[model samples]
Target: MEITIISAQGLKKLSFFTHNLQPFIQLTTTPPGAHRSHVYTTTVDHEGGVNPTWGDKFDLSNIIDPSEFFYNKCSCIYLYLYTNRVLLGPRLLGWCGIPVADFVDGMASVGTVRWLSYRLRKKDGSKGHGVVNVMVKLDSSVFRKKGGSDVRWLPEVNVGRVAIGIPVRTLPVVNYIIYYKTIK
Candidate 1:
């Protein structure tokens, strides 16, 4: 998948009193706790404009294995904006969740670029401070379904052994123990 961040609108200031500000996107193509090698970031917009144009495109592949498990469970792409301050640390500006599957199907049917506008949201899913506009296209040439499952709902378990010992003289021993080792 090729994701292009065309622009953004209504970026919030880091503080009401300060004038210096910078902004950028910290983008990820998968839900939380997934792999991170697919993350894409843009350079900070140093002009301090409320609306910034990135015009940056990123390729997303191998973020999730194209298997039944991931295909069924995977949902959205996350976009987070931050303020790159000179003296102060980066501040979270806002976030947005893009439903990739919903748009990808339509893009495939039309075989054309898809443009979308996602309302920025806070971590709590309330309306945030901005809106992001993007263009995306799936590179069918790089798409492939590697035959394997990326996840297992239920894991295998190992069960075995027990040992019991009683007190002897002035020494105390293992009262009870279960010992087991997983087999390959």
Candidate 2:
């Protein structure tokens, strides 16, 4: 399988930060009910300046066109990105499979995500992972393509975009259903 690495720095080096990751305010997945927290709502300053308008991360626009990406010079492929923080997970950017128009049944997934939420740590020191709600805010990035299977993985892009919201996995919790829409 061929892979493509989309970068603002250079086609060769993917390490150098070139200011391309933008954050968009929306959710990747929403079960029956999940709170809409203002996780991301900011703009990016490309000049490498300190103190951004909203946060350190820039709001990334969701890319639906597979044409914008070039992989192995030829073969078309779907694109998705994940942040260093994989606690949240990956999201679908674009692919040649199914168009997004047919997607979006209810709470449509908008962008890619890699949540940084503070999930429970493991006693064995491995990594406690699950959809458990805690008193503290999760250091999450957000994920896309929850109920659907359109999700892709693009580790080439270090950090991508995500529409902020709770994962559909945590929908069963009574607290989630009660405070999904009210909080904004």
Identify the candidate with maximal TM-score.
Answer: 1
lDDT of 1 by residue, 1-184 (tens): 6778888988777668768557788888655445655678988777747888888888765564334322542457788878776677887778887763544454433236889998887766788888999987765432445654342221122222245788457766668878999999
Cα error of candidate 2 at position 67, Å? 44
- Model 1 quality (TM-score): 0.68
Choose the strongest candidate by lDDT: 1
lDDT of each: 0.68, 0.24
Predicted candidate 2 versus true structure: per-residue lDDT over 20-139, tens digit per residue: 333112222121124433222223223312211223232222322232321112221121112221344432221121112212212123242222222222323343332111111111
Question: Which residue pairs collide in model 1, if any?
Answer: none
The lDDT of model 1 is 0.68
The reply for model 2, stretches above 4 Å from the true place, is 1-19, 28-184
Each model's number of backbone clashes? Answer: 0, 22
C-alpha RMSD of each candidate structure in angstroms: 14.9, 20.6
lDDT of 2: 0.24
